[model samples]
Target: MTNFEKLLDEQLSTLCFKPNEIVEAAVVEVDRHKVLVDVGLHTTGELKITEFMVPPSVGDYIQVVVDELDDGEGNLKISHNEVMVKQQLDDVQSLVENKTTVDAKVVEIRKAGLIVNVGYLTGFMPKRQASIEYVEDFTSFLNQVFKVKILSHDQIHENLIVSHKQYLIDEIGGEIARLEAPVEVGGVYEGKVTGIAPFGLFVDIGSHSTVLLHITDINWDLTKAVIEDFKFGDILSLRAKSVVTSDNGSQRICMSLKHMDMSPWEKAKDDFVIGERFKATIYKIEEETGNLIVSINGIPGVVENKDVSWTRMTNSNLNNVFKRGQEIDVVVKGFENKMGFESIVLSHKGCQSNPWESINEKFKVGQVLDTVVTSVSEKMLFVKVEGDVEAIVHVREVDWINPFEAIKSISSGDNVRVKLMEIDSSERKVSASICRTTEDPYKGIVAGTKVLAKVESIRVNSVHLSVLRKGKKLEATLPARYVNTVSRWLPSGEIEVGCELNLEVSMIMSGILYLKPDNSERAQSSFGTGDNPFAEAIKAALKF
Candidate 1:
């Protein structure tokens, strides 16, 4: 070596360069495999082409990090990737301290988090911090850029954690604050349904502010409502019913869809007049209240079970009379509209002609007509007379003898002649008598009149007998005294049903005949004892 060359080498060695030190270097030579850069050291530093993201041309200055002081071939080795990574870490640290955000691209997806590229260094975003909502598919965000805030940083450990949800909240927080002022109670706004739950629906009004629409506030008839009627992503006009502060000190809005529309009963008074009839369709029958929900001109009305029919129904099963989609005429009884609630009261029977209104015209006292027995009770017999009006035949008015026994003889659907004994139009009551159709047999019978009666039944103390007189049967009661008198002549044990006997009518009261045996001694004295003419004449008169 010459003296001047040796002097330049000694001068370059005085630059003071060490390994792992980042310094600015100027590109001196560029080749396909390596880029030679001058770091002002004893020798030029060489960087592999793979290390530089963008190829560096000659005379271009770039940041580089010293990886080794010398290679085995006496060359200085540096890395461009390591230098870029160090610069990015320093920038990210500054951003974290200042609470600033930066754009990051999702490069890879992992089970626990997403691998994102922030400038030169890779960052990690956990699944929970990815977005405000739950992320189902992380691959959808691959290659997508999002502004993120640094949640944590570990430069020594190379742990860079970022949150995309925090960035979204900060970005939209200003708009939400502006909306809170105008969102007062009773205000109306358009919102989109974001989620559906069993209790209610979640809707986003504006600026990503979510509110709840409770199930009760959705409609007036919750019994007939279902959650399936609504769906997610549906746009609905909602009314702000209330504002509540949550435990987290955040404002929550309670909305309503029903309040946005006028109530059905708001104009009910003008539309429904009492006693006026309107055709309506039965829509639903409430099992809880036993009320028939009918729609008249698209307005819902209720017809209680009591108002379903004029006749008292069996078990109040209005479902037997009214059904879904059935069209029937109903009369408006009344309506109420108060405090944002509306209801219309209706009656189905009121629209029909009242059978009691013309009851007197169709039936009169002492009118005898054929009727069909509809139903039988212990003390009364229900019969359907002319005009389909029901008249009750009480047990007392059923027969001249035992009224209860007469009820057993007739059954439902049996034909019988009845006389209308009483009619009350105001009370809507009609009473008939089955025995009054014939003439009274005791009208002309006088005391001491001899008659022959058949023993109907024999009791311990008395005997019940029936006599045929003038084609009418008359029931007579023989008292114990009279029965003993008869027992003297004929053994009481021998008295059987359908046995004939001679008796004289003693007294008649309250439609009952009192009888005694014809054993009067004065009658035997009038005609001498044997084969007495009076006795013969009495027997002849009785046709015994």
Candidate 2:
């Protein structure tokens, strides 16, 4: 026999030990088949090779429990492997009941489970017990130690199942329970990226657990690229928006990176006040309101096209001024809760810088000079004013013999000198007496003269009369009725927006002259007492 076997025989020669009794053994000679263990008794004990935790070569020390007692000399034989297996089974059962923690190393991988070697024993860590996440590679965890909880054990089948994920969770859960009550709504946390999906990212923050950082939660600038660009191991700071537990006992956490720092609106408050102006560019256009959605830095607001005054231009022309890359000075109008901040009303109208700034710039009121008719329409003729390219005049304002007839004869290439009559910058329009160049028939009529007038329109109790005027406008009354017939016309006649009228000034009050039509052909009747004459005349004429 080997020296170890001799030592085991000598140690057990006097003592009578029973099987299933745990006993301490002193180091002795060890081998592949058996170990000569001095069981600290009168005689040494013999430990079988299969009883070792693993296949021992030599010089390795181990403890074992006696499996059986001898008949004659009463020597004990111990099983080291069986003792370890039983200890692990008891430990795992204790963990399942009390959730105790055990440190274990990954030894080998089998079909559906990991062979874990706890300090005292070996336990099975099935795929389901590995992690909450899916495990793609099992070999990567070889020799790695983890705090594990024994989940289940089968004494009859000699099987053990353990979970490392649950062990961490139970211990961490205790720590989390000791932490403060509820998480603040906008509280921020530092976390690691656990996974990535097309729609969002998942982050792990200790007890904050797997918080979701949606694609929208990323910084506005990086939202589009965050999905494919972010790595699995990236660490990011995020804000917790909400937390809720699911029906299945899983925790859900909503997170945001965009608001992890200061909100853009709050930061914007310091940069832009109520009336401060800034050079802003249009970032986006809203088709519904015809408004430009503009952004300063990351702060967003709108500039309505209607709010901006653009004259002497078309919509397409206005589009050029506020296009994507175009910038303009805008005053911060005001903040609207529903509409955000309103900014400076933009205007492209002529001001001091315009070439028509000088009131006394060469051209006189009656100085008829030659100029090309750049634009001619049915009612107006736009002429290039003097040598000044910026100034122009309408046909009515151009001293012409007969502006109406004269404008018809003029074309785009025709040349004419327009006599400037009035220049009022406040109204932004010019007035000229074109008839001064033509014959003024109205000038010959005295202030109180009874002139022949053609009846142009009929009202409740009077008629609108017209005499040839200087312009295309034939003089007429607004209500076109007798002073007494004002109230009657308000209800009866459906006066249209565009209609012809003629009248004589009955009286002028406050420079606003009152007028009555000259209906010399009709006989006079009592006010409101006679049948509605206009209606009666219409019915008589229709005879329907």
Candidate 3:
């Protein structure tokens, strides 16, 4: 190497020197990037233009700190950022000693204090000393412009401490204190999300204090979402739920979005009704019941698996059917308590069952149909037509010459068309009719009636009477007065049968008919006769 170049290599060394180390060099040239200087050491040292307060022109006098050194095999390594930081720290130290304030820029964030640029010098601002009111987002001030109070400085490390909030706190603490003091239960306030933790978030609610936000306080939609969906420095409107004081008298504020607002249960009650259908989203598979906890318009409900096949079928079939943010349809079953919504109960199955199931629509009264004769008795026919249902048609209800003839013609297996006479849902039975499907004939019959009677039985002067037929015996009546007429006459077995007579139906009680004889011709007989036949008949018979 040439002599000048050889000397230049040695001069480039010792760029970093001790404190207060001074060096001189010729300003060979100056540029925006750097200035070439012949420090006249072993060779010459160089300084970047950024290191200088003012850029130097060519051939101008320039002074540079001998901050570091390196052999010319590589360029000298030096930092103007540190040198400028040291000078700024010295300036802030003087201000701290005098208790002065100056505008500054936050340079670095650390656990203990903020390194700030005060008057283009460095300073340290401790967290507590930063403000009387808490500063929620201190990191946002990094490289941000602000006015700061000079707090303290360290000479050895050349650290300068400053606080922007301290100056502002002195100006605004009273107003913020007034605003914070009157907060009551259920009172709401605006806040910003400043910090996030496993338990909750920390929010600044304009109270000069930061309040904790429990995870449960977040909206249901955001609660179930991953924690990463939100970030620090987000602003939110928080509702105050409680304010508790520590044993030391430090007030701890609790906030929520759900408690101060309408609960999901309350909202569901107002928005939905029983049997109403809605769309829903499946939140998760429950660990205990393995049911799907679905959200019906944000209300949660369980879809319990009715069977094992159903549970398994849904697994593969619904692999893509439901997921976070996926929408679905559901019916509101009922209400239940859940999460912060203490009244939020829900159901997805109650809508399936309806009141229409119990009403029988196919059957009605007064209808004729074929029926199976189930039982036969002297007075009635019991039959079943539809399934196991049984109905009875009385023999008196048959339109036949006599019950015997009706029985002979109507066998047990005969398909007889009958009318559904009556139905009682409470009794779960039907009454039918084979003869009186249209109207009941005996319903209009009067109690008093005179008719020709036949002596079907020889019971003294008493005899069974028929309206027209004598031996057919469709219906018969017994005389209430006949007992007296036969009292003194012949014995019941000695009385003649097949005798002609006159009878009146005196009165009918219940289903039994009572009859009285109208003729006095029987007075010659052994039977007595009077206004009642039996009273006089025995006297006349004794005279004969």
Candidate 4:
């Protein structure tokens, strides 16, 4: 304690003070739990930290009501909130009658507004009434004080409605006219950033209302600098692009930061040429497509997913491989000007050496390569060879017969061993065969070899038969026109898969076999209808 406070305490030791008396006190010390104040009595008074609308600091003066001159514990007690309620009830009875204003300290945050302690009552201040400026986070205003006029009151419930915005308007009188200044297109002016949105930034340029500085207009290369580079209250020199006013007296102004200076495209024409290689930075990645917009020498360029790599596009997952501001090599395909020099078409894959140039040396006909299936169709399977070269596996090449059935085992993302059958370097086409990876099942079998076959797949004009030779199944087609078997064994009538058939190898060439239904007497007898006269006599005797 100071010597002056000590002397004052000794002199006031005999002073008389009663409970419920309002007294002005100076804050002596304060902490998180309690506040100590000198009430000009023999002893200092204690007030809870929660009692004050706003926490008071040392040396501040506040009016409080004395609750008890001395408690049994010898500590003087006071109530700041009670004193405020008393003053509020005494002076401000009705807002309609008094037309009065009071200063309140922000004590709590709510969804619609801030909760504060108005003298003699608790009040609410709507968020819009707090300020004309946008408040991104209301929590930042906690514990601040504001002078507000009561808009509505419920004295019985100790509830008061106040507005700080009205207070500001009353204080600023004619200065509000500055917002009505006219804004002309192409005129440069300073703007203050107020809020950030997904599509753009909201800034105030001293017009009737806040304007939008669109994301596209914020930078020459949209991805070069991210939206996070800016913050609220940042001052920017911008040019007014367009202004529009709504029927409801609302105004919207569009501004640009890029137009404040000359575009880089103007100088790119002299420094760069078409069909040349140059280094570029990834500007942005399309969220829906795997397309890239790269910047070269500060000039924008487009790189589609097809030009990104030799691999085919399945999804917009290129963002996982590339990032904004990353440096990459690209080929300047061409430039086009629409209104202005919009962008130059670029190809990142073109900058690399083509793998097809050495196709003959790297692979040969019938060379087996590990392949992954890309997609499956009824008649063909698309696959990637060595994870790069795109190749097709026709169903006919997958198996000698029943090729469609073999296709069901292969699907997208499945690994299969296939041999390259044909490679057309000029067409950039590759034909592969999945069945040829294994040995031919009919290696030693010659033409005219009779074998037992099963109907594998039925067709309109013919039926595919599976012939087993040397414990391996080979495919053979039996033509309906060539079938000369017994009437009961006709393959064209109602042949089903798994039905056994007596077939003769009529011809064999180029790994394909032609079969004719057997017509031999032994073959016919084995499949013909059966009847006996002895069975008929036995049935006649039983009927009598």
Better of 1 and 4 by lDDT: 1
Backbone Cα, N, C clashes tallied per candidate: 0, 14, 33, 2
What is the descending lDDT order?
1, 4, 3, 2
Task: Quote the positional error of residue 58 for candidate 4 in Å.
Answer: 17
Mind sharing the TM-score for model 2? 0.34
Model 1 pairs whose backbones collide? none
Q: List the residue pairs that clash in candidate 4.
A: 84-120, 85-120
lDDT of 4 by residue, 1-544 (tens): 9999998888776456778888889999999999999977436988889887579999999998878867889877788988777776666656535556678889999999999977547788888778645567898779998988777877777677788765654554311224445777778888776656666777766664667887767776655546788875677899877767789966567788877765555666666777889999887887667788788876778888888866554342254457888999998877765432257888988877777788778889989988688777788877776434678888887875567888987768898889999988777778899878877677766766767888788787778887887667777888778643322354234466877876778887555578886656445433423453443343343345
The C-alpha RMSD in Å for every predicted model, in order, reads 26.8, 27.4, 36.2, 16.7
Q: Model 3: how far is 249 from its true place, Å?
A: 7.5
User: Model 2: runs farther than 4 Å from truth?
Assistant: 1-14, 24-29, 33-50, 53-62, 70-77, 85-103, 107-113, 124-135, 142-209, 214-216, 223-237, 240-251, 261-544
Candidate 3 residues lying further than 4 Å off, grouped into runs, are: 1-26, 31-34, 38-45, 48-56, 59-63, 66-83, 92-185, 190-203, 207-238, 242-267, 274-277, 283-295, 298-321, 328-343, 347-544
Give the total clashing residue pairs for model 4: 2
Give me candidate 4's TM-score against the actual structure. 0.41
Runs of candidate 4 exceeding 4 Å displacement? 1-49, 53-187, 193-202, 212-235, 241-254, 288-290, 304-315, 333-342, 349-544
Q: Candidate 2, residue 492: CA error in Å?
A: 99
Q: Rate the local accuracy (lDDT) of all candidates.
A: 0.74, 0.56, 0.57, 0.73
Candidate of highest lDDT? 1
Give me candidate 1's TM-score against the actual structure. 0.39
Error of 2 at 509 (Å): 99
Q: Estimate each model's TM-score.
A: 0.39, 0.34, 0.35, 0.41
CA RMSD (A), model 3: 36.2
